[model samples]
Target: METVAQRQIHSLLAKYGESHLNHTNELIHFICIPAIVFSFLGMIWALHPLAAIAVTVVSLLYYFRLSVPFALGMLLMSGAMLWMLSVLSQDQVLKVSLAVFVVAWIGQFIGHKIEGKKPSFFDDLRFLLIGPLFVLSFLYRRFHIAY
Candidate 1:
């Protein structure tokens, strides 16, 4: 029997997937989503490392409530992003993050244009967070991992 949490995740993923049916859009998302997440975190890190850490922690807590597997995946991904941010000088981090963030969002919009549908987040803000899990769930399926 699917637990309440599992059902909720399933429903959210299904809703998020509705607008992402185009192959080109899916491909664009596969690249741009991670870039957006990383650059977003990088920007926060530039402001203050602790702020970025707190964001990650809070995001992980949200993910954990939805799905432990996804939470773990995000934990690893966020850790790697944080480590990469540490490699940059504080000044450079903001510049690079700003550039990437702008470009990635542009790519996302273009993908949506090709998809002929507005992003799911426009309907509901929580879909913003759901987007990452929607992408990660693909990898989980490929590895035959239950999420």
Candidate 2:
């Protein structure tokens, strides 16, 4: 039987998958979404390292409830992104992250234009969080890991 969390994850992924039907759009997301996540982490890290750490902890807990393998993968990726963020000077983190965030969003809009669909987040904010998981689901599939 599917656990409640697994069922929820699958449902959310299916909803998220709808607007990402175009191959070019999916390809853009495969690159831009991670960049957006990294930049968001960096921006949070700039405010306070603790704030960034807190987000990571909460996010991992949420992911853990949904899928253990995905949570682990996200944990590793989060660690690396945090490490990269930590190395930048405080001012540099803000500037660099802002630049990346803007560029990544531009890429997202372009992809959506090609897809001819409004972003899922416009209809529901939680899709913002679901986007990264959508990308990770692809990785999980390639590895034959049940998520």
Output the number of the lDDT-best candidate.
1
Q: Which residue pairs in candidate 1 have backbone atoms (N, alpha carbon, C) closer than 3 angstroms, thus clashing?
A: none
Given candidate 2, what's the lDDT at residue 74?
92
Give stretches of model 1 more than 4 Å off. Answer: none
Backbone collision tally, model 1: 0
Each model's Cα RMSD: 0.6, 1.0
Local distance difference test values of all predictions, in order: 0.95, 0.93
Tens digits of per-residue lDDT for model 2, 19-137: 99999999999999999999999989989999999999999898888888789989998999999988888889989999999999999999999999999999998898889999999
- Judging by TM-score against the true structure, name the best candidate: 1
Candidate 2 Cα misplacement greater than 4 A, ranges: none
